[model samples]
Target: MQYKPASWLAAIPLAAMMGVCVGQAGPSQVGPDPTLPKPQRGLLPDMVIAKPAPWGDKTPTVPDGYTITAIATDLKIPRQTLILPNGDILVAEGKGGNAPNLKPKDVIAGIIKARGTSSVKGGDRLTLLRDTDGDGNYEVLTFAENLNAPYGLALVDNNLYVANQDAVVRFDYQPGQSKASGPPETVTPLPSDINHHWTKAMTASADGQYLYVGIGSNSNITERGMTAEVDRARVWRINARTGEHKSYATGLRNPTALTIQPGTDQLWAVVNERDEIGPNLVPDYLTSVQEGAFYGWPYSYWGKNVDERVRPQDPAKVATAIKPDYSLGSHVAALGVDFSNEAMGAQFADGAFVGEHGSWNRKDPVGYKVVFVPFRDGKPFGAPVDFVAGFRDKDGTTRGRPVGVTVDPKGALIVADDLSNTIWRVTPTQAAKSQQPVAAAQ
Candidate 1:
């Protein structure tokens, strides 16, 4: 897990960054108002890259009431998943991002990050899984082929939309069909230029009239310059019916996952914050997506706390930064999130499930599992409870990395593990047999 310090790290003064703590953050770092520590710029940033480990007969550990199963294996880098109306599951498999490394540190960081990820090539297609006998076992089938690194998917009014690395494409679907009937049509093109944060996370409005796309910044703190960040780090609201798009909000560095809170039209996002200042200097968060609100990227983090490294700082923008609603801890790399439902059982019925893809840096590893953050009155509160874990062994070796999480209406949690090229289905112990009508009851 140790990495030789890059020669460029010598530029940082040891004294300025030496005193900060390098272990896991306490509870104060897990909720709203996370205690922000002083930025600790270090010589190489205490690099910890988890080497790949085999799972063999091991599986992720869920809470006592639930059991986890690998419904589909040997995928092509599954990143996100969607549950269809007819009880089918759609898997988005791909990897992208062509952001050129701005400095030597970028290259070094990239090399180290790759060590923890799946080496398989992206399928670049949508795969459908059908529970043919109304049982847990799934029959894998191809829904569509030849996609451009499809990452985010949504279905509205029989129109399936996929957020590709460069554009939003749509496919017409009919109930019970296991595959797409025709080729995908581009709804709109996205800002693909130098996609430092290539994931175009997406979600549709509850009414199915609008599609909100979360576009990330072109560089960490705009090192690529503001010109490269035009129309980046913001959510775009697209008219689902007409294909027209406009900026809905601004300054969110990398909103990795987006969802409409189960009962409300309000959009929510799990954002991945900037890094390198300190392991816990800036915390990744889950927040309500407010229209026309700026969440502060590059200039500030966690609302109004200025990051000194962003050149030509915008004090005005910093002042307008909207503080996030909840913090999910730093460098957790939450790649997936879905609001919980009745099928998840009472304890998890009113919350959101976050799939932390695990961290690639920091003195100690964090994440590598799925967690449930309870919510009341549609607002998140309390510390996150580990619902699916054991992806990282006690020795810090990476076994699997969870990406997108989806709550199946038929009573289960669908998890995408790109690190192992698998799709895991987690259901309450014996709950599926008797809880078939639970979602409707609620």
Candidate 2:
């Protein structure tokens, strides 16, 4: 079924229907707001899409001490990034989802959402980038081609694991190699049928003994039924050698990105909570993922805040729901998260950098850039600082939206801009003083 361009007209009445007042909840309501308003259901979720406007000669704005530059451009939907031991950057460039439209509204919503994404087809491969001359600019090369839509990347020992949409696959990795020559070996099958949230965020343990995969729920509040949510809305821990897997954490609607905190064994996740529950009800969060902990998905949110819309409720399940550690604001769509232990400069050296992919379900768009959430003693400390901005222009046109983020070997920040198909490099002016050559593949 083709999505009509005029389908957006169907969403125009959403603001009045929901009584949406933009900025009702300001930045004060961002982190762990003590007062969360009651959920307000709308017949159709509010649609505020930022139309794509490619970055002509402009770059993203950064904080005073930091500068932004484009390292590579003309990529096809780069989502996540992995910095190799030899300083080579591996970019997973693809997008894949086949969730069927459940209603007429779904069709209209799909059309509006599609308008925000890149028009170019996905590359469906891992592209390698290397700054051979110690310059900020990178020389791009195709590392591997003709694969599924890969999202997460993890390198353990000599094995590189790729979290494809449907499965986790393993490939042989060499220290400075630009290409992965052999076919991939499937490690474990991921739940992908009726994939409402298709991204499978994966991270490996520091010892390389275990793998963690984040699988999102099938639909908002299980509207698609519980049968579609089996083995989902949770993080799966897999044996790197045996492929044996079990649920590590549960009840997260969409844990978009996962990472292991440095100097500790604790695992953390950035979750995208459910929508259609007012513009400021459920807040997206970043929390430490505990083994077997339930963070509350369809039945509840933020501890025991029961979502009445999830019918045939389970009071027992809601009682077991654990509250998230910190909230990143409602509809922020916190996607990419990484610690700053190995990051450059003092300002960014103690926190997590999160890539906010922006929001479409709110009357006012939020989270169009990257932010830094400070950490003290391995826990979130203060308010989130806006590290990168300028994704959305004054007229609300999106020049680019950030997805996956990583810190290069020299500690410079690397951001994958999917809308503009560009990889941006952020470096402190001081760090740029000592340039180091990127080792070229033999």
Best of the candidates, lDDT: 1
Residue 430 Cα positional deviation in candidate 2, in Å, after optimal superposition: 2.0
TM-scores of the candidates in the order shown: 0.92, 0.93
> How big is the RMSD of model 1?
4.4
Ten-residue segment with the worst summed lDDT in candidate 2?
A: 433-442
Write one digit per residue (lDDT tens) for candidate 1, span 17-59.
2322465544458888898988887545556767788789999
Residue 204's lDDT within candidate 2 is: 92
Every candidate's lDDT: 0.86, 0.85
lDDT of 2 at 207: 84
